[model samples]
Target: MKLPILSQEIVITLQQLEGIGNKTILSKIGSIVCSSISTLDDLLSFWGNLKGKKFEAISNDDIKEANRIAKRIISRAVDENVGIITYYDEEYPEILRQCTDEKGKIDVPLILYYRGNLKALQIPGIAVIGTREPTPNGVKAGEYFSGEFAKQGFNIVSGLAVGCDTTGHVGALKVNGVTTAFLANGLDWESIYPKENLELAKRIVANNGLLLSEYPIGQSCGRYGLVARDRLQAGLSKATLVVQTGVTGGTMHAVNATIASKKPLFAVEYRNDVDISHEKVQGNIMLIREKGAIPLRSNGIDSAVAIIRGTDYKQVTVTQPSLFD
Candidate 1:
């Protein structure tokens, strides 16, 4: 009756197997919460004792192929200075542990492939998300709000996409504050999505911040991966702030995940000032009106950030120069 808590290499190797992916592991998670199983040998030993065999083991050929692929990934990970952390790892982020679907199943990937400081994952973070094509004012809100959060010692979390995501990362960096950029693709420079932000990605890691992803090295960005990327942005944060979003886009995925988790979902009040015909602010309005999301004021401390900042000591804001106007 042992649980399978594996090492970095074992977890990464399991991820390559179609039959033993995160979902499969999570389905049996309740049984493996303790220390009875801690390694590949322990797992195999436990598997041999199963009377009815609740889990399915992969074929020998599949195991060999997975190991071969994992070896290459391990080499690339070392060459790129990338680090791997398993769900059972002591350093794994607790905030990300709350990422689950409607069925209450664990939604986080069993293995997190990251760069920069892993310690940042433990820091309280605020996710800043919005459309890839934000209005001029939308970008301003992203930068202003994110920079303000950074000053308060909260890690700025955002998908390292263009538009609001770019502004979110830039805003935090301007103040020399910590920011964690979650990518839809590999953390490697060549495989980083949106070649335009490749330098920005490097800058984040250089500033002692963090660049994170669930995808392994050599994996390119895909459409569904971006949607999946949104979930992690919301799941890893204390709250999620929508700088701007249309009726439908990748930002909504984060918004939905935040609400599903019953965390503080905040949308910028910029939607109120904009014209009704504005598409970008439409989703913002919907979130405030229909989704019970707290409205965030652009000018000063709105009700939401007030809850985030609390009665803790306050500090003057440090605004960052915009990277893209």
Candidate 2:
């Protein structure tokens, strides 16, 4: 079968596989289909016709949730002018293509529901995520790096949540740099969360940044949705930095995803003791020790910027543009 036909068929089939992980199922099918497996029927038969196999046990409510997501995506795609990006789409991030499985299955998402311009994917991005409620130190550090990283030409990415995440976005804006917010809730590309950042989110777009989500527009925010959102924020970036987190927090999820994707992960370590309740600290330590993430210097903004920009750490001499006297 044609590649487009096969890809389309597999997407629909994976979409219908209740209780099956969409990414996992798509990964499997993607491996075969990408390798010259002919058609959906041939692919299904090869896999023992797993398609349409009823789950041994699942409530109607569970099925309804899946349907709700599907329907919401469809309705909002039309109603809110959203666009659907499948793994096969040309605009799929090339960075994610590096994450191939042992069986040659890529970690690419099956589909990404999007509502904004695709330009953000081409820019070098740094994700900053941490506890929802941060300490004063965490908040200060988050702002510092956010501005520093943006000045280095890295587009800052974060959940639009309060605390460190929000600070990251604002810091980027303070430098007059671009930033993108990846949301956990289903959002029309134009929508902003926490209501307060609504203005900030607007400024980002006006500055040629974007607001993005994988969920269909209008889907309610859920715990799992936030978790899913974190993965995308990590996946979409060249590297990630956790400014401050408690022993357990969503920042860890983003860190883990960065590790699993084999991208560079870095942590901003405060000189003082980081609290466990903050939920981002332990994860950062674990990532550094076990996952090999580097510990970034708290005071080396210039050095970090030099490394990112591939230039010497010296301040550049500004050349004044000549104007009519």
Candidate 3:
């Protein structure tokens, strides 16, 4: 049977079914499954109708599971004022509509749960990402670069991880500029991973910045989620600044996505006379020498901003209220 047009609530409920992860559903399963199945009933019967009766994600015993899932998510949404924007929704950021994973596959998220100003999504954003265990130089670079970009009217995009990510958000905060934090876990207090940053998350909202996550209220961030969510940092930005990173780690994932998207990448370049070891700046060194990334030395934000403006993309302005009710 047919169901009403795929609603945000229905999309969340459908996610609870087995074999329906975000990457697989949107990329691997393709649009055929989404086009064929309008609701939960179609989830159980679509394969059966095409393949055989035995083909299904769940049996009759779990028929009500979707309802239960929807109830929990909706209840939390009401309780915490969390809002959801899905792939099909017009409010979903166009920058993320074609997010590319590490392998270059189009792994767009099916939905994102958000809190704070939706207006921030309308601004052109530049991602400032780097190591979680940053050197003092990384910290200064992260904060300085973010503050400079924010001063110029570009929103900052980053994960809410400590070290560089925290500095990025705080830099924007320092300037009262808009920033967006793409989290690996849910936006709810209970599930806001790294309990230490709960206050930082709150500050972002209080300052009219945005908090975004693909996970719902109860899920904690795992290693896989941490890695998978990196693409989003690069995906949301016009260009990216690698404040500091090692040769390989989660930050490289964002770097790869930025490169794959054909967006410019600028790596922080410390002076040769500076006492910092090569180990700490290996990522920056390698990127500039081998990866064709731009060298963003200290206080070179003018050049960085110049290159960013040279890109061909239209600015978007959108107005919307924050509260779901």
Candidate 4:
């Protein structure tokens, strides 16, 4: 499907307005003009109405700064060959558009900067997330599950972090399958986080995969941006799999977002005979025993595939003691 392209003016307007934190004001503006922003008159009319209203509280200085930033970002994107997709564009992932937060509010990005195959978003996807530091066993599990899923025509989606997220992308790539990395920073090569994944990001684009981000060019990753990026990881996927994680960290954030979005969640089940004190697998155990995520056996890739495909597959339940116990 050919994605709908937004006009340069509309893209600039959305990018400028993205810094607004007040949802009420942003929503009001979006409702009035998002659909008609292609018309310069409508955009100007909205800007004209911004004065003396709650939106005006943003200040002209802020607006000017935002516009200036938007122009720079656009110039950088063009020079770097990055693609921009707005919420108003049909190219934006529909799954992401349906994602909601704990409050049942639609949680989605207003603008996305991506490098590589935009068609990757059109495929069925499963997000694989876990701790940054994975055990040897955790690495094996991530590779096994992600590779199996990729072979079944599922696009592996991940944060492109170290450990399990990187393993997930590598596993998919090993099968010459499509994988999309959603970064917490900009899509520019200079902005790629974890520096180690720079080569992997290149391989993704070269192999027809995708690298996506909501941040504009030159913006570095922040604590809140990483937290916010988790939702997009979950939102873009048909389901989210926690290969291995500790109780705390970004993996758990993705877990919460997945559940809040009402998407199916699968966590790898550790061997009963093995030591459960392993920190990497602790989050997986907690998710299954406490949060009701389905326990997926390492060899049960078929069942995992079925869950994402919405097929009726045999369900496996784990009765392990809760970590909190």
Q: Highest TM-score among the candidates is held by which one?
A: 4
Better of 2 and 3 by TM-score: 3
222-320 per-residue lDDT for model 4 (tens digits): 898888888888888999999888888778888888888778899888774452688777888888889978887755676667677777534634354
lDDT of 2 by residue, 150-180 (tens): 8878889998888888889988988987788
Q: Which residue pairs does candidate 2 place in steric collision?
A: 245-279, 245-280, 245-281, 246-278, 246-279, 246-280, 247-279, 248-279
The per-prediction tally of clashing pairs is 1, 8, 0, 0
Model 2, global lDDT: 0.66
Ranking by TM-score: 4, 1, 3, 2
Per-prediction RMSD in angstroms? 4.9, 8.1, 7.8, 4.2
Q: What ranges in model 4 sit over 4 Å off?
A: 1-8, 14-19, 22-26, 39-42, 50-52, 56-68, 102-104, 272-275, 312-325
lDDT of 3: 0.79
What digit string (tens of lDDT, one per residue) describes model 1 on residues 1-325? Answer: 2334666665666667765668766666434545545455654554455443334455545645766787788889989999988777778887777785533445886778899988888788999999889888887888888988888788999988999999899999998889998887888788998999999998999998998888888889999788877888888888889988888877888887887887777787753345335798898889879987776765544445666655331342313332322
> Which sections of candidate 1 miss by over 4 Å?
1-4, 33-47, 50-57, 102-105, 271-276, 309-325
lDDT of 3 by residue, 1-325 (tens): 2322456766776677665576654544335554644555665565455343322545644545865787689789878889998886778888888788877878788889999999899999999888888877678878888998999999999988988899899999999999999998988888897788889999999999999998888889999989988899888889998888888878899999989988889888776434146465788888989997887765566667777888332231113321111
Where does the lowest 10-residue lDDT sum fall in candidate 3? 316-325
Supply the TM-score for candidate 2. Answer: 0.70
Q: Of the candidates numbered 2 and 4, which has the greater lDDT value?
A: 4
Candidate that beats the other on lDDT, 1 or 4, i.e. the better one: 4
TM-score of 1: 0.86
